[model samples]
Target: MDMKQAATFIIALLCAMCASAQTETPDTISSRQLDEVVVNVEKPQVRAEDGVMIVDLPGIVKDKPVDNILEALGYLPGVMNNNGMIWLTGASNVTIILNGELANMPLQNLYQLLYTTPVDRLKNVEVMYSAPAKYHVNGAVINVVLKTPTPLDGLQGQVRAGYNQAHYGSYGGVLAATYAIKDWSFDLNYGLTSNKSWSREETWSNHLYDGKRTIIEDDMRRIGHNWSNTIFASASWKTLKLTYNGQIVSDSKSWNLSSGTLGNYTNAYNMLSPVGYHNIALRYAAPFGMTVGGDYTCYSENRSQSLFKDTDYLLGSENRQDINRWHVYVDQEHQFGKWQLNYGAEYQHSKDHSSQHYGIVGMADNPDFDDILNEDVASFYVGTQRSFDWGLTFNASAKGEYYHNKYQHNWNFIPQLGATYYKTPKSIFQLNFDAQRIYPSYWELHGGTSHINDYSTIIGNPKLQPYIQYDAQFNYILRQKYVATLYFQYGDKAMVQLPYQSPDALNLIYQTINMNYERVAGLNLNAPFGVGYIWNATATANIMNRRAKANHFHDISFDNSKWIFYGSLTNSFKFSQNCPVSVSIDFSYISPSLQGIADLSAIWKIDAGVKWLFGKKRCCELDLKEDDIFNKWSPTMTISHAGQDYRMKVHDMTRNFKLTFIWRFNGFKPKESNSIDTSRFGTGK
Candidate 1:
C-alpha cells in the first residue's frame, strides 16, 4: 500500500482501539455539606500582565494531544509555527527567548531543542507585541519560562526517538538529564539527527533581450541529506552560571538536477558547518535594592560549500566567523508606596573577524577577502509602573543609545509606552507602542558572488544599511477566551532580495537592496472554545493590507500594494478520560500575498495527529502526525511589472508522516542558558 493509505489505515485502527477501550464509566460522588458545596474555580489560562500576555502553558496542554514544547506553542492566540519557523499574526518577525533571556544558538538548533524538551518543564509563556529595551530585541517576542529546580531533587532525565517519512525516511534520537542538590544545579542534553529532504521547482522566464522575446524554462529537483549533533551543558551556583552550547553538522550533501530548454545538467552542492558557543554570567543582588550582572560570550562557526556540475568543478567557497562579545549592566529598583520605579544602564561590545574565499572556474569573476568589524553600544533607560484604584495600570520608558561600528556611527533615542485597563473580571484592554532599529546580516553586507547554474547567480552588495521599524498595537480581551487586535507597522529603508535579469546578458541575478518604505495595517481575531468534554477548538483570522515603495531599483522604480487574509482552525478530540487516547485535526488558509515586486497565489493545508499514552505511570508516549495531507501548501509566484516578467512554481515534499516515542524518568526537566548574537553567523542564502 502507499504511504497515504498506510496512514489512513493506522488512524482507523487507533480509533477502533479507543472505541473498544471505552467500556468503563466514571464513578459518581455524593457530597452532603449543607446541601450546596462551594468550589473555587481555577485560574484563567491566559491573562494580561504589565505590557505582555501570559499564557499558562501547563493548563493549556493538560489532557491535550501536545507532545512537546514546540507543539504547545502553536496553540497560542496569535502564534503560528509554519515548518519550524515561528511567526506572530500580522507581524514581520519574532524573537524567541528562554526564561526571559535569548539563547546563544542558531535558529535551527533552538527549534530542535524545543522539539526534544518535555512540556512538563515549561512554567508559562509571555507574548510581547513590542519588546522593551531591556530585552535588547526588536519586533515581537516569545518568552518561554521554565520551572526552577528545587533543592533535593535528586536526578531527572528523558530519552526520545523519532522517525519521519517524506520523500525519504529519516530518524533521530535525544537524551537529556538534570540534577539539583543543595545550592547547585547542573544540566546536560545531547541530540543527534540524520535527516533527508527533497524539493522541486519549475521556472518560466519570458526574457525581453534585444527587443526579442525569449521563453526560458528550467525544471530543477533538489535532494539532500545531513547529520547534525547538538550538545548543551550548564552548571549554576546561586546567581553564577556557566554554559556551553554547540552544534556540529556533517555529511551535508545536496544534488540538484536541472533539465529543460536551456540544457541538461546536474549540480552537486556539498557543505559542512560546525558552530560553538560559550558563555559565563554572574548576577549579584547588593544593598539598597540594586542588582548587577555581566556576561561574556565567545562564538565561532566554519562553513564550506562546493559546487560541481556534471563531474566538472564549478566553484568552491569557504566562510568563517569568530566573534567575542561581552555585556555589563546595572539595575536599581525602588518602591514608592503604590508605585514602583526601575532604572538600568548597559554597555556592550563585539569584535568580529570574518573571512570568505571563493575558488571559481573563472577566477576573475569571484574574489576572496577578509575583514574585521568592531561594534560598541551603550544605552540607558528608566521606567515606572503604577496601578491605580480605577483599575488602570501603565508603564513608560525612554532609552538613548550611542552605536558605533566600523562602517558607520549614529545616536538614537527610542520611547516605549504601554497601558492596560482591567476594571472588570470579564474584559481587558491593552495598548502598546515601540520602535527599534534592525541591522543586516554579516554576509549580506559582503561583496561576493556564487553561481547556481550556468545562467543563474547570487550576488551580494556591501552597501546595505540598517533600517528602523515602528509598531503600534491595540488589543481587547473578551470573557477571557476571545481576543481581538488591531495593529500597524512601518519600516523605513527596508531591505529585500529581488531578482533581476541582466539587460545585456543572458544571466539572471538575485541581490538584496534597500526599499524606501513598507507599511502594514491589520486586524486579528482569535476565539477558543470547548464543546462538552470531548472536543476543544481554537480559530484565528487575520486580514491586512501591505504597501511597499522603492525609488531606485536598477533601471526602474515602482510602488506596490496588496490586501491579504490568513486563517486557521485547530480541533482536538478526546475519546474518554479513561482511554488515554486523543486526536487532533488542523486546517489553515492563506490568501494571495505580495512580496517586494512579486505576487503570490493562495495556499492551504490540512493536518492530523493522534497521541497515545501507555505503560506504568504513563511514562511512555507514542504520537503519529501527518502534515499537508493534500500536499497543497506551496504557492506560485509571478512578477510582471517594469519590463520584468517571470513565473515560478514549487512542488516541494511538504506532506510527511512522523512518529515519535518518548520515555521519561523521575520527572525530567532542563535548565535555561545564556544567549549570544548569532543572527549573522552563517553565509547568505
Candidate 2:
C-alpha cells in the first residue's frame, strides 16, 4: 500500500486498540437492555457497521408529521442546507428524494411543498453524501422514506391538518396524508402561508483601489406568500417495487429596497416563482432474488424576478429561469455466505435554461446560455457488507462514473471501506476510509449574467476540474448511547467559491472554482439523554481546517489557507399537559472565515414553539423562529467584485414569529391491525 493508505491503516489499527473498550452491546447502556440507534443510511459510515446515530426523525417529533415538513428530517444536523440554495456544504450541490424516487422539481419549490406538507407524513429523511449502489449521480442523496410499518402485511393511512400564525397577524395552514394498501401506497400533502417580514441594513465601505467610499442604509418590507403541494405513491409485489413522487410549488415575495449612496427612495422588488416536478421508479426482483430498479424525473420550473426602481432603466424587468434533470438507474444485490454484494449502473442527463427579459444591463444579451449545462453521464458502483463473529461488520464499496459535459469528459472511481468492532457488551469501535469524486454543477460550469436582480452576474469555467476527496472517520460508542467521532478529509481539485471581479456589472459576483486544493479535518461528538420533564439535549463540537494544497491567484497574497471552528448545543423540552411546547437555540461561530480575510463573527439564532392539544389526537401550535434575535452585529459579511469595484454585503435579520396548529381525526390504526402505536418505539437515538 502507498504511504497514505499505509498511514490510514496504521491510524485505524491504533484507534481500534485504544477504543477496544468501547466495543459493547445495547444492554450495557442501562440496568434494562435498550437497543441503540442504527444508521444503515446508504452504507456510508465506516465507524460501526451495526450502530451509529440514526438521525432519528420520528423520535424527535412527539406528534405525527402533519405538523411540519421540516420535522421529517429534523434530527439530522445537515438537513438545513441553505447557502442561498440547497447546498450540502458552503458550496456543494444537493438532491432530494421521496420513497426512493427523485423529486424532479425545482429545489426551492420543493421546500415550498414541505412548508405545506405535515412532517408526520414522512417516515424518515435519510441523508447521505455518498452514492450507494442503488443511487444515481446527484451529489448527496436525501431519501424521504415515508411513514410505514415493518410487518409488511397490512394497509395503513393517516391524515393530519394544522394551522399556525405569527405575531404579525400572518398565518399558515398545512395538510398531510398517506395511504398504503397491501401492494400500493399513496400520499398527498400541502402547505400554504402568507407572511410579513422586514429587514434594515447599514453599510460602510471604501473601495481602496477605486479611490471611492460609500455609506448606505436601506430598509425593506416583504409580504411573502408560499404555497406547496406534494403527491407520492409506491407499490410492491413480492420483490418488485414501483414508486412515484410529484411536487408543485409557488412563492411570491414583495420587497422594498433603498440605498443612501445609490438611491434615496424605498424601491419595491417583487418576484413570483412557480415550480412543478414529477418522477417514477420501477424496480424488479429477479427470480434469483437479485433486484433491479430504474427511475425517470421531469421538472417544470419558472421564476419571474422584478425590481421596482421607479425608473425605466432602474425599473427592473421580470426575468425567468428554467431547470430540469433526468436520471435512470439499475442496481442489484445478492447474498454470498457472510457477505452481501451490491452493484449498479446509472445514467443521467441534465439541462438548465434561463430566460431574461429586461434587467440592469448585460443580461439582455443572452436569454439562454447553452453552456450553462448539457451533459450525459454513466456510472457503476459495487460493494460488499459482511459481519464478523465478534459482532463486527465490515462494509466496502466503490463507484466509477463518467461524465460527458461540454466542459470536460472524465472518468473516476471512488473507493470506501469501513469496519465495526464490538469489543465488550457496552462498547463499540468503528473506522472508515473513503475516496469520493465530485463533478462541477451546471452553474459551476457556466454562471453568467442573471436578469433577476443586482445580485451580481455569474460566470462559468470550461477549464474546471473534478474534485477528489479522501475521507476518514473514527468513532467510539459507550453503552450503546453516547458517541464521539473524529473525521478528516483531504481533497485535490477541491471545489471552492471565490469572488470573481466583474468588470461590467452593478453588483459583486462570486463563482465556484477549483483554483485551490483543500484539506479539512474535524471532530463531532453527541450526547443524547433519556426523555424527562425536560426535552432531550445534544451537544456537538467541531474544528476544521481548509488548507491550501495549491494556489494560483497572486493578487490575493496567501499561503497555508485558514481554519474555522463550529459548535452547536441543541435541546428539546416538552410539557406533560395535553399541550406541548418546544424551544431551540442555535449558535454558529466562524473564526474570520477561510483565508483570514475578514473579521470573526458569532451568530445566535433561536426558535420557540408551543403545541396545544385538546386530546391525544388533536392539537394546535404557535411557533416563533428568528435569526439574530438580539439584532446583534451582522452575522455574515463578505466582500466580492461588484460592478467595477468590490462591495461589501452584510446580511442581518430581526425576529420572526410564526404560530401553528395541528389536528388529527382518529389516528389511522390499521382496521384489522393492532392498535399498538409503534411510533413510540425507538425512543432513544
Candidate 3:
C-alpha cells in the first residue's frame, strides 16, 4: 500500500481501539472534602521530562529586577546573550518558538518582541536538545509558553513605564487587559518604544602580495534614531481560538568614516518594515483520551530602504521586499494503557518578491534588479511512545517531506529515536538520536549585493546547496538538582560564510559557500544550590571542541579546529524574612572561540539589580537595574587566512542603567485557561 493509504488505515484502526477501550460509567458516586493542608518547600527551577529540559521562569526570576523576557534569560541554564543575539551552550543551530509553534519572524523582530513583552506574562521555557518530527524543525529548539488569562468572569489590566540612560535616553510604555465571561474570552496587549544611540567601530587590515605588505585602517561612527510599536489580540470560544499579531518599525541612521583615507566615505539611510500574522485553530477531545486538532495560519512582511552617499547624485540605492506565506496542518493523538500514538501532516506555500535600484553619477540611467520566487513543501510523520514494565520508556518516529522550488525538486526522509531508564526516583538516564536537513533563506538564495563603502562589499551566492546532519546525546539527572550531558554531531557538505580580500588591491568581500564536512563534540554541567533561608544560587558550565575541513580560499585549502569554554553564575539574597525587597547578581564569561576562519577573543560581564514591592496587595512594583556594571563586555575579532590579517572592535551602548514602575489591578481571581498549540505554522528566518 502507498504511504497515504497506510496512514489512513492506521488512523481508522486507532479510532476503533479508542472506542472499544472506553470503560462504562459507574451507577453511584460520592464525594467528600478533606481537611486543608499546606506544605512549604523550595520549588525547583529546572526539571527533566523524557528527553527535554523545562525551566520555570516565574520561580527563578521572582526576586530579580527583570522587566522583559530577554533580561530573564540570563539566569536560565545553558543560555547566553551575546549583544542582542542568543547562543546555545553547545549547539550550532537553534530555533526559537512561541507557545510550541514557529515564531515566523526575522531575528531583529524577535528581539524586539522579547524586549517589549514583560516577564510576568511568561510561565515556562522548554529546551529540546533534538527536535522531534512533529515540530517540523531542523535543530535544537526553545519554546516559550506564555500565561493564559484566567477563565473566571470579570476584568484585569496592568500599566507599566520605564526609562534607560546610556549614550542617550530611551523610554517605553506598555498596556495590557483581559476579560472573560461564561465560555468566551478576550485579551489585548500593546506597547510603544523610542530610542537614540551612538556607536563606534575600528577595523585594521593587512594585505600581502609580491613579498610585501600594505596596511589600511578604517574607523567609523554611527548615530541612530528608532521607534517601534507592537500589538496583539486574541479571542476564544469553547474549543476554537483566533489570534492576531502585528509590528511596525521605523529606523534612521547617519554614519561617517572618520579616520579612513578613502576620500571621505559617508552615508545615511532610512528604513521601514511591517510584519503581521493571523492564526485560527480548533481542538476536540473524545472518549478514551483521543484528541484531534487543526490549524490554518497566514503571515506577511513588507520592507523598504532608501540610501544616499556624499551627495544624492553621487551614489544612491533603493530596495524593497514583499513576502506572503500560508500554512495548513492536521494532527491526532490517542492514549491507551501504557501506550500513546501521535501523527500529523502539513503543507506550506510561500511567495517572495524583491527589487533594487542603483544610481551613479556617470551612468546613463539607474541599474535595477527584480526577482520572484515560489516554494511549496508537504510533510507527514507518525510517532509512538510506550512504557515498558522494566522501568524504561521509549519513543521512535520516521518522517519525510517533498520540497519543490521554481527550478528544483527533491524528497528526503529522516528518523528519530529516544530511550530513558529510571534507575530510581532520584536518578535517571536518557539517550536521543535525530537526523534533519537545513535549507537557506530566501535572500541568501537570491544572490543580492549591497555595498558597504568604496572598498568593501557583501554578496550572496545563488548556487548554495542544502545540508543534513546526524546528532546524538546522552544525559544523566540526579535528585532533580544536578545535570550532566554529552553530545556529538557530524555534517557533510556544510556551508559557512567567510571574508575574502582581492589579491591585487585592498578590497574586502564577504560571501557564503559550501564546505566539505564539519564535526562538533561537547559536554555541559549544571547545579542549583541554596544556603539557609536567605541565599540561593545556580551555576552552569560548557566545554566543546569543533572542527571544519576542506574549506577553500583562492589557491589555498585548509582545515580549522578549536576548543571553547563558557560558564555562568547567578546569586539571589533576601535581607530578612519580613522585608519585601531582594537583590540579585549575575556573572558570566566566554573564552576564545572560532567561527569558520575568524577567531574571537574572550568576553566577561556583570549585572546587578534590586526589586521592591509595596501596597496592601503588593500590586505596585519598582525595579532598579545596572547592566555591565564592571564595564568589561567588549568582544574582539581576528582573522588570518588567505594571506590576510584583519581585526575589528566595536564599542556600542552595551552598558546602561534603568528604572521601571508597574501597577496591576484585578476584579476577579485568576483561573488557568486552556489553549491549543499552533506552533507548526509560519516558519521563517
Candidate 4:
C-alpha cells in the first residue's frame, strides 16, 4: 500500500461512497434551485451557419469550475495548455470532447486527466481548428464539454480535490454525479491519480569506427485509475427528440522505471502503457430546428518494454505491444432562420495489431516477432450554409473515404470553403479554403523496434500515401477587440522519414519514406482588453522545400525557418463582492534554424500564473504556477545521415510548481436576476 498509500486509500474510499450514497436531500429543499439555475452563463449553442466552431464551457467558467481538461481548453482563443499539455497550433492532431461525446484518450492519459477535473466540473470545451464535416474528418478538432443537470433535476452532485508539485509528485480526487429524472441524464465520474517523473537522456554518437557517449536516467513512478459512466437517456413526446449517449472508460496505468547508462552504453529502458475507452452517442431532434447526431468509439492500448544492454550491445530486444481502434460516426443538421442544412456519414474499422515477443538478452540475435495489421475505413460528409443581407456569409464542406487495408482500398475526397463579410461591426472580413486528406496513423503503421528511441529503427508505412493539403485562412476583426489572421499551407505527397546509415542495421538507422512536395505560409495577431485585459500575438515565417525523382530522392531540405513567437497576458480583479484576482503571462520563441550540415539554432520559453478567488462561504482559490521562467536549458544537434550524427542535450523540466485547492458544496437553487426561457412561447421572426 504505497502508491501514496494506495492513493490515500482510494480517496478515502471515494469520499465514503459519496457520503453514504447520499439519498437524503429534500425535506423542502433544492439548494435554492442551485443558485437559480447558475444563471445560464450563456453556453447553449446553435449557430448552424456552417458546422464546427464552438467555444463554450459554462460560458468560460463564469465563477470557476471545470477542473483539468486543460481548464476547459484554457479559456479559448487559439488555445494552448501546458502541464495539461493540450496543443492546437503546436498541432499534434487534437481531439477531445464531452456531451457531444468523443475521447480517443492517450497523450499519456490526457496528461493525467487534465489535472483531475476542475472549473466547476465543466459543461463545455469545443474547439475545431479547422477540420469539420461535423466532427470526424480528422486532423485538428477538440471538444470536452461536460455538465448537464437541471432541466428540472433529480439528484445532482460534484466534488473535487487536488495537489501538484513540479519535478515529481501529484495527488487527486474527484466525483461527479447527475441523475436527471424525466428526460434522462445519468453521469458518474470517479478518478484518482498519483504521479512522479524525472527524465534525463543525453546521447552523442558519431561513428565511422565506434565513437560514443551516452547518459540516460529516467525515474518514473505513476499510478492512475479513472472511470467514467455516462447514460444520457433522452426523449420527447410529439415532435421527436430521441437521445442515448452511453459511456464507459476504465483507465489504468501503473509504471515504474529506473535507469542509468553510458559509453559502450550498459543500458536500461522500461515502459508500461495500459489504456481503455468505449463510447456511444446518438441524437435526433426535430421541432423546426432539426438535428441528428451519431457516435461510436472504441480505443484500446497495451504496451510493455524492458531492455537492458551492455557489452557494446549489438542487438538485444525484449518487447510486447498491442494497439487497437474502432470508430463509427454519423451526422446531420438543419436549421431555419439563416438558412443552413448540413449532412454527415462516417464509418471506421481499424485493427493495428502488433505482437513482438523476443528473447536473447546479452550478445545480439533476438527473434520471435509477429505482426498483424488489418484496418478498414469508410466515410462520408456534406455541408452547406448561407446568410445574405450585407453581412454575407457562405460555407461549403465535403469529405469521403474508403480503405480496406494492407495499402489503402480506394475512394477519397476532402474539400471546404468559407467566406464572411461585414462592412462595419469592427470591420469584419474573412475567407478560408481547405482541401485535405491525410491518413497515416496507427503510429504511422506498426511502431516497434524502438530502443526506447535513439537507437532509432522505428518503422511504419504499409505503403504510405495519402497526403494532400491546401489550407488558407484570412481574418481581420479590429476595433471591437483587434484580431488579424493570415495563413496559407500547401502539401503534396508529403509523408517522409529518412535517416539512413544502416550497413545491415546496428544503430545509425531511421526509416519512414514517401515524399514529393511540401509548403507552408503563416501570420497571426489577436488582441483584446475587454474582459479585464487579454492579449495574444503570433508571427510564424515558413518555407519548406522537398524533392525526389532522381537518385536517392532528389535532395531538398528546410528545417522550420525563423519567426515563431507567441505572447499571452491576462488580468482580472474584483477583490471584494466575493473575491477574484487572476494574473498570467506566457511567451515562447524559436527563430533560428538550419541544422544538419548548415548549423544555426535558437529557442526560448516562459510561463507564470497566479489565482486568488476565495469567497461565498464554501470557499476557493489557492493556485501558484511557475514554468520555465528563464530557466531555459538547451542542447540539440542534428544531422541526417552522411556519417550519421545525433546529440540531444536534455535538461529543462525544471522550475515547476502547482499548489491548488478549491472547495464547493451547495445543492441547487441560488440565482435569478432576469431569467428567460418559459419554453419560449410564440416564435416567428
Candidate 5:
C-alpha cells in the first residue's frame, strides 16, 4: 500500500479499537478477566517522574514472545530495534544502561549482553529524553533496571538456546546463574554465538571527472562467519559491589566479491577483537549519602584486509589497536524533605596504541601511519531535584568538562533542566532541555585509507573536531496510557560521512567531515489500548522535519531539508489461560527520509511471532519469530544534488526466521554493570 493509504488504515484501525473499548461496560470488563484470578491490586504500567518515563517491563513482556532483554525492549512504546540497533523515536542517538549504570563495552558486546539476559531479571525500564548529568550520557537514554535478589532466594539460574535461519544458519546459547544469601549476592552469565551472515549491495554512481561523465556500477556480495563469546560476573556485599564484563569476537572467514565495471574483485577481511572491563563501586546511604566508583577497561583488536583482481593481489593492509581506559567518579546526594541535592565529579583517561600498514602493487597512493593517542576528560556537575505539594516536580543540573588530547584541548559547559506537572492523575505534562558534546571516533581522527576498489577509497580526516548537540522536548500524557511529545534538536558542526569525487583525479573518496549544522523538529505520539484481556495493542507515530546545511563540502555547498514520517503498530493476542499460548504481529513503516546529502526511499515491514509455555509452572518456553515477511525493509538511497549523482540499493538478508527455547531453573536475578566508552575503540570502519 502507499504511504497515504497505510497511514489512513492505521488511523482507522486505532479509531475502531478505541470505539470498541468505549462500548465495553463494567460488567464486560469484569467478565473479560474472569479466566485469570484478580488480586484486587492495580499498578500503573507507565508513569513519568524526574524527567524520565518508567515502564513496568514485567507487565509488558508477560504475554510478548520475547525471551531476552533486548527483544523485550522492542515492545516499549516509541522504541524501535532496527536491525539490532535500538533507537528512540525522534532522537538522533540513544544510550542503553543496566541498573542505571552504563556498560563499559562496545556496542556489539553490550548488545550481546542484553541478548543473553533473561527478561525475568528486568524490574523496569526508564526512558529519558534528556538525561541528567549524573547519568553521564547524552541525548536519549534507556535505563534497564534489574531486580535484586532477595533473602531466601537462594540459587537461581536459566539457560537459553536459539537457532536462526536466513540466507545462512546461526545458533547461540546462554547460561546465567545467581546466588543470594542474606545481604550478599553473586551473579554470573556466559554466552556463545556462532553466526553466518550474508548481504549484497548494488551501487550505480555517475562521476564527473576531467570534463567527462563516467558511470560506474558495482554489485558486491558479502559473506562472513563469526564467533562471539561474552561473560559477565559480579559480586555484591551490602553496599559494595565488584563486577567484570568481558567479550571476544573473532571473524576469521569474511570475504566480499564485486563484479561490474570494476571487472571482478575479491576482498578478504579478518578481525579479532577482545575487551575486558572491571569495575568496583561502593555507596553509603542515609546521612552520608556517598557513592564512589572506579573502572578500568582493556581493549584490543587486530584486523587485516586483502584485495585482489582476477586472482592478482592488488592491495593488502593490516590494522591494529590496543587501548587502555580508566575512569573514577564520586557522587554525593542529600535529602531534605521533598527536595534532594546531588553533586558529582568524574575523570577518565584513555591511551590508544594504533598502527596501520599498507602494501600496494600498483601506482595507488599508500596511506599508512602508526601513532599513540592519549585523551583525558574531567567533569564536575551539581544538580537538584524537588517535588512540590502542588504536584510539580523539577530537576536541573549544569556540568563543566575539561578535555585534553594531542591535537586540541578545550572546555565545555552543559546544562540540563526538566520539569513535570501532574496535578491530576489523568493528565501529565513534562518539559526537558539538554545539551551535550559529541567527539569524533578515535580512528576517524587518524589519517588512514582503505580501498574498496581501484577507484573508490575510504579515508579518515585528522582535522575532525567535536560537535555540540542541543535538545528540547515537551510531553503530554493522557490517562497515563497515551503520550504526545514535541521535540526539537540541533547539532552544531555535525559529522557525516559523504562520498566525494576528485575533480583532478579518477578517485572517489568516502570521508567523514564536520557538517555546518543539522536541525530536527518532530512530534511523536504513542497510544496503548487493550481489547479485553486477550488482545493488547500499541500504536506509535512520528513526524519530523530535518534540515542540514554545509558551506564547504569538497568544493560544493548545499542546503537540504525533508519531512519524514515513521509509524508502527504492534498487537499481541493470548489464546487462553488454559492453553498458555500467545501470538504477536507488528507492522512498521518509514516514509521517504533524507540522510546527509542522500535521499532515502520509503520502506515497510511486517513481523510476527508465536510463543508457547509448557512444563510445570511454565518453566519452559518455545518462541518462533519471522521478520520482514515481505522482504521490504531496506530502502534505496539516491543522491542527485550539487553536481553529484549516485544511486545505491542494498539487498540484505534482513528477512529471517528464528526459533528460541528458554528454560528457567529456580529463579533468575541480574547484577548491575558500568558502561564504557568503546564507541571510538574500533578502526572506524
Candidate 6:
C-alpha cells in the first residue's frame, strides 16, 4: 500500500460502492421517503438586496466557538482584520468568492484555505460593493457560501484536533468526509498544520547618502517553523460539477541582526510552496425560465526561496517562482416577472516564470537572473434587475474588457449602478455605483530582486500600471437590526510599497510603485441585538479618511493625509439552561493610519472562547481559546517622507492558547445550494 496509499484506498472504495449502489435502489427507497417531507426555513442576520450584503453564517456562528473561515471572519460586520489582511470597511479593493465563483487560489494559497476551512462548512457570506455585470466582479466582493449537502443518503463526517501555546508550541489535525447517494454527491477535505514561532524586531533609519545625514539602528530575532496542508475535493452529478482546492507550504527561518548601519547580520531562510485550483462545471435549468452555466478553471504555482548568510559566510541566493493559470466562463440567468436578467462571458490566461541564483562560494561570475511574464484577459457582461410597485428596486450593469500584457494593451468599458428603496416594513434604502479595474500581480509583473541583508532589498515592477477605481455607496436599514453606511473610494494608478534611499550611504530599497492618487472616505455602523436572557450581541463601527500621492518617486516623494478609526465587539453568553455551556467575547480597535510612507500605530485586540457539549446528538465537542488577550497586539511603523526617515517595531506570535476537539458521526448536514458557481476566475494575488 503505497501507490499513494493504494490510490487513496481505491478512491475510498469506489465512493463506498457508489453509496452502496444507491441504497439498493427502489428509487432509493422512494427517495428516502421523499427526503422526509420536510420544510423549514430561516434566514436573516443581516440582509439587503440587489447591491448585495448578506450574512447568515448560521446566524453568526450561533453560540460561537467558531473554528475556521478565519474565525468566522472576525465576526462579520464590515469585516476588517489587519495583520492577517482582510479589510472591507470603506474598501480599498478586495475580492474573494467561492460558491459564487472566483477564488482562483494563491494569495498565500487563499490564506491557507481560509484558515483551514470548517466553519461548519459555511453557508452565506456575501458583500459586494457595486459588483454587478452578472458577478463578473470588480472592486469589492466577498461571497462565500458553501454547505450544499442535499442528501447523500447518509455517511457523514468530522474529526479534528488542535492544541497551541504561543511563544512556541503547536499541533494540529483534521479530516472530513461527506458522501451522499441519490443524484450523487461526495466531498472530502484533509488538513494538517504545524507551527513554532517567535519574533521581535526593531528598526530606525534616516539616510541621505553622499552629503551626510545617515542614522540607522536595528535589532531583530525571529525563529520560525510553519507547516501547512489543506485540500478539498468535490463531486456533483446532477447539473455537473467537479472541484478541488489545494495548499501546501513549508517555511523555516532563523534570524539575528544587530545593526547600527549595517554591521552584524545572521540569516537563514527556506521556503517551499505549492498552490492549486481546478474546477469544471456545467449547469442548466432552462425550460424557458433560463439559468445556464459553464465553467473551467485551472491554476498552479510553485515557489521556492533559500537564502543564507550566517553572519558573514555569505551565500544567499536562489529564488524561483512559476505560475500558470487559465479560466473561462459563460453565464446566463432569467426571471421575467419582477424583471431580472444577467449575462456574462469571461476568459483569462496567465503565465509567469522567475528565477534568481547568485552565489559567492563557488562563484562563476556570480550573477544570474530571469523573468518571463504573460497575461491576457477578455470579458463581456450585461445585467439588469428591476422591481417596482412603489417601493423601488433597480440594478444595472455593462462591462467589457480586453487586456493583454507584455508591456501593455487595453480596452475597457464598465458601468454599474444599483438602487433600492422601501419606506415601510421596517425601512430601507441603498444606492451604489462602480467603475473599477485593477491588475498587476505576478510578483507585480515579475521584475524581481530580493535580499534583506547588507541593507535591505525587494524590488519588482515591470512598468507596473493598471489601476482605476471609483466607488460610491449609501445604505441604510433599520428594524432589521440597524446598519448604516456611507462610503467613497478613489484610485488612479495606486499600487504602493515604497521605501527608497539607496545611493550608497547604506541601501534601503523596497519598491513597487505607481501612485499619484488614492483615496477613501467612510462611515459604517452595524448593531445587532439581544439582551435580556444573557447577552448575545454584535457591534461594529468605522470612520475614515485617507489620502495619498507618491509624485513619481525618484527616491520616494510623498504626501499622505489621514484620519481613521475602527471598532468591534461581539459577545455571547447563555450561562445555563441546565448546562451545555457557552461563552464568547471579542473586541477590536484600531486608530492611526496613513499608509504610503508608513505611519501606522494604534492597534488593540482581545478574544476569548469556551464551549462544551455532551455526546449523544450533541455530537461531541470542546473548545477553549484565547488570542491577543491583553497582549495589546502590537504593530508599529513610521516613515517620514522624502530624504527618508523610518521606524518599525513588531513583536509577533500574537498571544495564544487553544485547545479544540470535535467529532461527528451520523448526521453530518452540509448541503444546500441551488445554482451559482462560476468557478473562481483566475484565483488570488
| Model 3 spans with C-alpha error above 4 angstroms | 1-39, 209-212, 251-258, 272-313, 361-367, 667-685
User: In order, what lDDT does every prediction score?
Assistant: 0.77, 0.50, 0.68, 0.48, 0.82, 0.70
Best by lDDT: 5
Candidate 5 has an lDDT of 0.82
Best-to-worst lDDT order: 5, 1, 6, 3, 2, 4
Candidate 1 or 4, higher lDDT? 1
Off by over 4 Å in 1: 1-43, 63-65, 272-289, 360-362, 668-678
519-553 per-residue lDDT for model 6 (tens digits):
88889998877664367888888888888877777
Give the Cα-based TM-score of candidate 1 against the true structure: 0.91
| True-structure lDDT of candidate 3 | 0.68
Weakest 10 consecutive residues of candidate 5 by summed lDDT: 669-678
| Residue 461 accuracy (lDDT) in model 1 | 77
Model 4: residues with Cα > 4 Å off, grouped in runs: 1-17, 20-49, 53-123, 129-163, 168-199, 207-384, 387-394, 397-415, 418-468, 471-642, 645-659, 663-685
* lDDT digits (tens) for residues 342-439 of candidate 1: 88888888787887787653477777878787888898988788888887888777888888887888888778877888988589998988887777
TM-score of each: 0.91, 0.74, 0.85, 0.29, 0.92, 0.32
The clash numbers for all candidates, in the given order, read 0, 37, 1, 23, 8, 12
Candidate 4 vs 5: which has more lDDT:
5
